[model samples]
Target chain A: MWRDAALVAGKDLRVEGRAKVAVNQVAPYALVVLLLFGFAFDQDRPLLVQAAPGLFWMAVLFSGLLAVQRSFSIESADGAIDALRLSRLEPAGIFIGKVVAVAAQLVVLEALLAFGVVVLFQSRLGGAGLLVASTLVSTAGVAAAGVAYGALCVGLRARETLLPLLLSPVLAPVVLAATEAWRAALGLSRGDGWRWLGILACFAAIYLAGGAIGFGALIEET
Target chain B: MSSSSSLTRALGISALAAVAVNAWWGLSLSPPDKVQGQLVRILYVHPAVATMCYAGFGLCALGSICWLWPRTRSPRWDRLAVAGAEVGAVFCAATLITGSIWGKAAWGVWWTWDARLTLTAILFALSLGYLALRRAVDNPHSRALMSSAVALLMALTVVLDHYATAWFATLHQHTTLFKPSPSIHGWQLVTMCWSFVALGLVFAWMVVHRYRLEALEERYESEGYLVAIEARRAEGQPVSAAARPETGRVLVGSAASAERAEALVEDK
Candidate 1:
């Protein structure tokens, strides 16, 4: 299962590497969202600084949607999904691989957005341990849930519009926990950042296990 | 004949009677609270309706599980799942509106980030998404499979969301009615219990009717396919071209008789 996962993840990364859509489009879009948040705050430096953690994750969530859509769309075109089904690889492996690939893209996007938040919002970064831990755990949770939902909507007519409507509510907890954790890490609030990180880890674990177990049934539908 | 069965008729009548009696008792007989006064009246309907909302989703999750299981999979379970979700969505909306009203009266705001309110809002969105997915998929089996997966996912998220929000600061009251020592006694408690019965009956009635409606829809859809196939066969066109992949199983040997096709369509 692990070998199959590696193979699928490698294939997805290679396709993404050649396409360069994440690097070229999604990453820039994430930064653009950050800039827009700065504008919405009316260039109030302190307000933007305090709001940076939330704005950063909001940008990640939105861009993460695109990455997920891209991941599944690659399969929908040319009946690639059908081919994957016929390949006899385990569905759980495919699910994890997709999660890994989407998380990889999100981590890079988060790095860029982190830089954008600091430079644009004029905020200082602290609590690096909490910051990095929350980022990875939150990304994993979001990716697992996103890939699972993407698989559900793939090959359907209204998938493009339907995916966000279905996915955003589920990811609300991740956004909430991640924002709180980042707020604490960035010293914007006086709460335990580690507690929020624990909650994020729980969210990630639940979705990861649920997604793997349920992915076979989901993709089998198409 | 109407779609309702005797069971539904009985349930509907009981629900109406219970609700009427509960309303009179709650609004008139039940004395005002020492703390909340008239504002406590919202309590009778709000908690009962909210309970039904969760019950409906619980039923939806149960039906989805039955459908997802290989041995128990059936269109009946899928219909139950959709019915539960549709009814649950209605109750969920009611829960939010009534909760908002209670918030305004008690908290001096139309809404707040209270844990219970946030959880219900998320659950409402989840149910809406489930219904939307149902509408998007054209194939019944695929719709069942996809929506069932989503239903289970929603169930999981609701549990996690409950805890996640509970850990946050909350303005909503904790369980007052269900606690060890009851907060209220006499008429308030009686009215509240009756409200549950009334709303529970209403929920059952709606779900039964909704389930029947879904069954009729499936029949209508299959019958429509047959009529189309029959039309194509009469026109010397290949009937296979008109047959949908999902309805293909019903087409074999069943579409052979024109009289049966005409009768089915006419019955609708």
Candidate 2:
């Protein structure tokens, strides 16, 4: 299953590499969100620094929507979904693969957005290792959740509007936990970073298992 | 249908009696609290409606799980899920409204980011999303499948949010209603108990009516599908085997024609 997942992930990444939609459009859009947050706060440096963790994750969450949409839109064209159904690949593998591909895109988007915050908002990063670990784990949880819901609305008329509504609330735990973890990493508050990390890890595990188990039911055009 | 109508009628009478008794006992007979005074009146409505809200979503999740399991999967489960979610949404709205009113009287704000308040808001959004999802999909089976999966996910999120809320300290009081050693006594407790009975019956009545509404809509859609399929046959179009009505889904082409047929029928 891991091998099949890798193969599917590789295929999706290759397609993304060729299209560069995520890199060219979504990454820049994430930067714009950073700017929007700055202006929303009236460009107060202290306020921006204070809210950097949440703003960064919000940017990641918003960009993730596009990445997940693109991931499924590739298959929404032609008879691509039917082709996958006939491919004999494990449904769990496909789910993991999509999640992996989306996570990779989100990680890169997050990295760039983190940099943007450092420069634009002058927010200092204190615990680098904890920060990166939290980012990767939280990205996985968001990716799994996003892909699980993204595939659900594919090929529907209101999918574009419905996907965000379905996904955003489910991501509340991730946003809260990840922001707390980031706060701890940045030394903003005397919070237990490990506990927040544990929450993020549990979220990733639940979504990964859920997507793998439930993907088959979702993929079929019942 | 006759039995269900009679059952609803019985429920209506019981609900009325329960509401009347609770109102009289709670508003006039019950002594004012030493602390909150008249403000305590909101408790009778708020806590009971909030409990019913949670119960509605619990029922929705149970229905969704049953529908997901192959052995027990049925349209009735799907209908139950929809009914539960719709009624849950209504109760959820009521909870938010009454809670806000109480908050203003007690906390001096229309809203606060209290743990229970935030969780209830998220649940309200989730219920609305579930209903919106049902409206977006045209196919009954697909709608059922997708919404069932979503309902399960929403249920899990609710649990996680509950824990997360508890994990983080906030203004929302704990160990009140669900405590082993009860908090209040006398007419307050009695009225609260009576409110629960009234709200529970009202919830059951709403779910029954909503479920019947869904069944009628399903019947009308199926009839529309048959009409559309017959029209396609007359046009000599080759429909796929998958377009069979037995599958409980209308093909896209047939769905469009069905909309037209439904419109035409309405015109007649």
Candidate number with greatest lDDT: 1
User: If you assessed candidate 1 against the hidden native complex, which CAPRI class would it receive?
Assistant: high
Q: Interface Cα RMSD for all candidates? A: 0.7, 1.5
Candidate 2 residue runs with Cα over 4 Å from true position: B1-4, B160-168, B229-268
Predicted structure with the largest TM-score when compared to the true one: 1
Off by over 4 Å in 1: B157-169, B237-268
Error of model 1, residue B21, in angstroms: 1.9
Report model 1's TM-score to 2 decimal places: 0.91
lDDT at A161, model 1: 93
User: How many backbone overlaps does candidate 1 show?
Assistant: 0
What is the DockQ score of candidate 2, to 2 decimals? 0.64
Docking class of 2: medium
Per residue, candidate 1 scores C-alpha lDDT tens digits across A62-171 of 99999999999999999999999999999999999999999999998998998898789888999999999999999999999999999999988999999999999989
Candidate 2 lDDT by residue in tens digits, A63-100: 99889889988988896888888899999999999999
